[model samples]
Target: MIRFFTTIGGFLLGSLLITLLLIFALNPSFLAKQVLSYGAKSFGVPSTNKVDKFLDQTIIDGAIDSPLALTYLGLDSLNFLTGHKSKLGDYSLEKSESDYEENLKQLNYLSRFNQNDMPEGNYNLQIKRFSLDNDIRGYESFRYHSSPVTQFFGAHLSLVEFLTDQHKVNNERDIQFYFDRINEVPRVIDEIIGFLDKRAESGIYSPEFVYIKAMGQIDTLSTGRIEEHPLYETLEKKIDEINLSKNKRENYLGDTKDLIREVFIPAYRRLFNTLESQSKNAREMVGVWGLPNGNDYYKHRLRIYTTTDYSADEIHNIGLKMVSEIQNEIRSILESEGYDISRPLPELYEVLNSEERFYYEDSDEGREQILADYTKIQNEAMKKMPDYFNELPKSEVIVKRVPVYSEQSAAGGYYQSPALDGSRPGVFYANLYDIRATKKFGMPALSFHEAIPGHHFQNALNIENSTQTLWKKFGYGTSAYGEGWALYAERLAIEIGLVEDPYELIGSLQSELFRAVRLVIDTGMHSKEWTRERAIDYMIKNVGSEESEAISEVERYIVWPGQACAYMIGRIKIMELREKARNELGDDFDIKDFHSAVLMNGSLPLTVLESVIEDYIAESKT
Candidate 1:
């Protein structure tokens, strides 16, 4: 959910940079562009320097441009930058263009330094330089091929979540900041509406599915009464919990209600109207293949997500092969357990899901038990990590049920990283809306994947690490590394004896099979030209997923493009490298050491990761 925090920085005048950061709260762009394209000689600071002050300045300056990012990263509390907490961020097309140009200049600025001459010890420099070299590809080749208000990442919907979840209202200043940000909604909405219209004018309309989902979400925002709305009600509840007097609380509520009526509601309505107007012209286009030069865009997204240049057909073939191998393995296990091998996958899943022993009751108590079980599983997983990981993250992880309101749209499970400053622990959300997704047998692997030994562990390590710069902790393409790490964690549990039960082992395999299936589904929709229904049907028949789960997963792949492929591709690379190290080291090979080398550096492209592994092996041999 975190956007990439670019640092347009170099070692230079500290006073000038500090002045720019202070002024950025009011006009971030002009000074930001100046800071980004500043004197080139400053970048000549030794590349081997682990504590690159220039790079730190770049991240801080770039982050200053995005007010919402500060709140997410917990940097809003910093004394020098607190003025931005009240502001929303720029979503104007002009800003997008400026960002694209800034990236180009950043690349040029990076070229002034000596990438090849960089110290072997400073992997951060290598990773950042490598990332910047590729950051502009997606922006340059397919800028108009994507939209902000889509089914997955709609700005209108995100605005609500950001305010309710991220915007902390602690004192009088924060309370006013909350209302002040609300006051900026109309401007933000106007920019989004304008961007949508402008994109549509260029034949870049979102598909029927995208706009329809967005309009429905907007309806949720626009249709509710002012007081009953989640935004207002949440504020009322928060205000009540705090030490404010009754009169002050009433005034607060009154001010918020007035803002909702005059500013928030009308802005959402305008957004809704725009989406409705656009939906009429929306094509049934499901894939990027429908856009102008879409095949190239899909390839670019593949590079962006997977960090590998594997073509669509190659990925499709890999998915096919993996599906066959995994299904055979699943059949072998079922046969050993005396289950009928002749039955279909969906029927097998039905039998498994129907076991009342695996599920809780359909009541509030059942929901609470499910959450408790998840928490138990997470706690257990965290305990075993010290033997495997050399550096255990101090930050803890907690399991929480998805809020009833947003659970409808939530995935089965996901991890939110800890705050960069360690003020917040990582969170793993289990959506109990669908009880089938919370099957007891799957808890271990799911817990391992979403919490301990997965996202929380890896992300917390990145956030807590003293050596890595801010960009490494919060950069783009971390998802490629992260999703892979989480997926790999599912299998890692089996090796570490976390999945000792026979059924739980099947659960682990099933989780992997789901990712393997994703590889095929993603490539099928984008490259093989499979319709949405075809992809959903394939999953239902192959993985025995419920139709609803299959539909949601397929829709996610449609919107995200090549992201689903990252899990398997990255795991394959990591596994391949591990095997190479193991074979070379033989008796000397240590799983703990191998893991340290992988996790110690911040997330990297698979290719760069392979380089890191090679260096580790060579060092070990010496």
Candidate 2:
């Protein structure tokens, strides 16, 4: 009887093992999850213990399904494990719809787990819920005139930039992956063209001006020779660093050139032709106000970007009020400096802008100096962190210039977070495309906003925090939460004595003023049907921005509705919360604690943020 029992146990165990092997073979994602779990455990992240398993599995599946998201997260192994050896994911509309449904499915599965049962569940739940809700809403509701290509910052521009900057090329395998992506560019372009054609068929189109810019951008890409192309040149630069033989190097270069010329350039030329022909049907009107159900669309945008229920008129009024107060403060500062306050602000800006001392030389040396000064500003802000921040990011933030190709359309400066593995530091890309246009006074505040105690602090902390799940760390937060904190950091620098010079102080105020003007102009164009010129004029008259700068900003607003409004709206809420905390806690209020409370839970909606602050206040009172 004992021998018979032993034989049965052995048979059952072998059968179970074989079944699991078959499952792993059939479902690669299951095997991928097991591999990811081991990797996560090596990094001290728990995957099998509790609710975190849900998060780890979600991130694994998400990265496998989306190549761009995968690249941004610095995860490459899963792409190969999932049989996507050399290509990004499909960009077709059918793929997009299927992905949307999959997200909804995951969301449903996630909702079944009770968030209250876990230690850090609320933060994870809120971030995931907010992300999924917004994506679903945008995908389902906002498809009328939405095309895949945008002259300013869509897949067309961002993909090439991503390949150059974010995609790693460390070894022969990585190089082959790079080649595969480049070779796939034509198919991607064709997919986008299909979407554009669908929009055209639906009587929806990008504005005529968008077509003009898109064609110009495409022309810039097409007219350039393959040898001088950004794609080709970046690969040439990367290949020289690899220790490959001469024959291999030549072959790699040849492959890259063929991909750029035969595959990439022709695809762009095709896009250019498509846009040129489509422009004949495109309207002159720029805003969504002219599109089908435009009002509802604009309202959805306001709610989505600001994460608030505020109306267009109310936001407009808030912008107007803030502008008046900020301008008055500027006037008082100028009066104390013995400048004539009688002249209009724009004329004053013209005079101050002409001063040689206020700007660097329009040369390479001057651009390097701007970067150096920004570093200094970042260092100075770091010195003041102990006073207001209880926790700071472990990662460093480096300053860099925006890529030359996209600099014309890129904003002044933006922050990219460090890799999760700590291989790369966070980068702040300042637009030094036109060195003369870069302002010395503006550099200080920009540094503070984009680097230390701003985006770098908020994002890196969120990414590094072990308490939150993997999804919360990797998931993209709302524009309002991220942008609002950065803007508030600009003001905090002034409070902490970083902006001591009058000019630097003015630069900070001007930054605030710029966001305020965005509130007015963004709403003005999208909701009130203000002409593009009228919006640009409003920015110039109020904020004293240059014509080219105003035009770029207005065009950006035209393409990205309600995004510009988030900064001021978010800043105002953060300020209000701080004041309420201070008022309630009085002498007991700790700035560092207040900041940690705001940041400890990662980004949250304004409504959720208010409740968190109130909870902090109550806990402090006890």
Best by lDDT: 2
- Give the C-alpha lDDT of model 1: 0.78
lDDT of 2 by residue, 70-96 (tens): 677666767746645466657788988
Looking at model 2, report the run of 10 residues with the lowest lDDT sum: 42-51
C-alpha lDDT score of every prediction, in listed order: 0.78, 0.81
TM-score of 1: 0.90
Q: Best-fitting candidate, measured by TM-score?
A: 2
Give lDDT tens digits, candidate 1, residues 422-495.
67788888888777767788788888889989888788877777665545554545556778888888889899
